[model samples]
Structures are given as C-alpha cells and as structure tokens.
Target: MTTVSILPISDANGERIYRAIAPDKQSTGRTAGEALDALTAQLEGDEFNALLLI
Candidate 1:
C-alpha cells in the first residue's frame, strides 16, 4: 500500500489536496485539486491513485 497526506487548507471541502506515493519510490506531498482541474482543462491526463485521502 502507499501513503498519502493531504496538505492542510483553510477549507478542506472548498479545495482538494492530495499526496500520492508512486510505486517508483517518488512521492508528492501537496497537490491542489482545483489546480489539477485547471490543468485538465488544457491537457489530458489520467486519474490519480492515492493510498489514503484525508
């Protein structure tokens, strides 16, 4: 299993932040969903897999 921790935010529900530890031993600690959403608008990408989301 992987480990993930969403960065603390002023309003969690308002913004979605997630951390994903990939199988390659690389980890991302903080990422904004809204930011990704915006990126998704310009580019194409796949879904993210996270061990724990909170």
Candidate 2:
C-alpha cells in the first residue's frame, strides 16, 4: 500500500485547509477527508499501477 501524508494548514486569512502528499503528487481540500479523496483520485489507474511496480 502507498503511504500519504495529511497536513493541516491555515491560509493567509486563517482559513483551515488540508493538504495530502503522496510520492509524486499533492492535493488540497477544505477538510482532511476531501484532501485524501482528491489524492486517491490522482493516484488511481495508471499512476497507481506504476507505483505498485516500484
């Protein structure tokens, strides 16, 4: 399984955001779940397959 890192951050205006970082990609969302979902989508299909071969 691939490992991802989720970090909570604040914008210049102090709005909360979540950032999800994978091996070679990153995504952000309003919440942690949203961030993870975005990252998952990015990792699906060809990208996911490539990771498995590594």
Candidate 3:
C-alpha cells in the first residue's frame, strides 16, 4: 500500500513528494516543510522519481 507520509511543502502538488522517513527513525522538525527539506537533502540520490498515485 502507498502510505503517503504527510509533510509540508512550498508547493505540495508540485515536484517534491512526501518527506521520506526511515521505518525506525525519529524526525526532528517543527513543521512538515522543514522535515521534508531535511529528508530531501538527507536521502540517497536526487529527488526525482515516480511519486504520483493515479
């Protein structure tokens, strides 16, 4: 199942998707956007993939 991990965004319906989090990790942020940015930068490769669910 595609569980959409909710997170903030400058444009939620834009390029970036959810703030990918580890299955056994805790996040440190005040807002979703902040968390998203953190995840975006901390993740493995670039932030471009099949993130949409149709």
Candidate 4:
C-alpha cells in the first residue's frame, strides 16, 4: 500500500498551512483537504486509490 502523511505546519510568514508527503511527491496548501487534493493530482495511475493516510 502507498502511504502518505498529512500534517499542519506554519509557513515562513507563520500562516497556517497543510502539507502532504508521499514517497515521490509532496504538496502544501492552505487547508488539509487542499493539500491532499494537490498531492492526489500529482500522483499517477491508481496510486491515489490505494493511498493510506498517516
């Protein structure tokens, strides 16, 4: 199974943000959902379908 980690973080400006980390891809967004969405878009094939969120 493919594993991904989603966590909240602060940007350089101290703005709340969300980050998604996968084996081959990473993405950040203003919200957790957005971060996951962005990461999902970057993934190829059915990888997203078997994603295991951590």
| Candidate maximizing lDDT | 4
Work out the TM-score per prediction: 0.25, 0.74, 0.39, 0.85
What tens digits encode model 3's per-residue C-alpha lDDT throughout 1-54? 122254533444455444435443323344565654565455456432314221
Question: Which 10-residue span in candidate 2 carries the lowest summed lDDT?
Answer: 45-54
Write one digit per residue (lDDT tens) for candidate 2, span 13-54. Answer: 899998888888988999888988788898867554333110
TM-score attained by model 2: 0.74
Model 4: CA > 4 A from native: 51-54
Clashing pairs in 4: none
The superposed Cα distance between candidate 2 and the true structure at residue 49, in angstroms, equals 10
Candidate 4, 1-54: lDDT as tens digits: 568888889999999999999988999999888998899899888787655564
lDDT of 2 at 42: 88
lDDT of each: 0.40, 0.77, 0.43, 0.86
Question: Which of candidates 2 and 4 reaches a greater lDDT?
Answer: 4
- Predicted structure with the largest TM-score when compared to the true one: 4
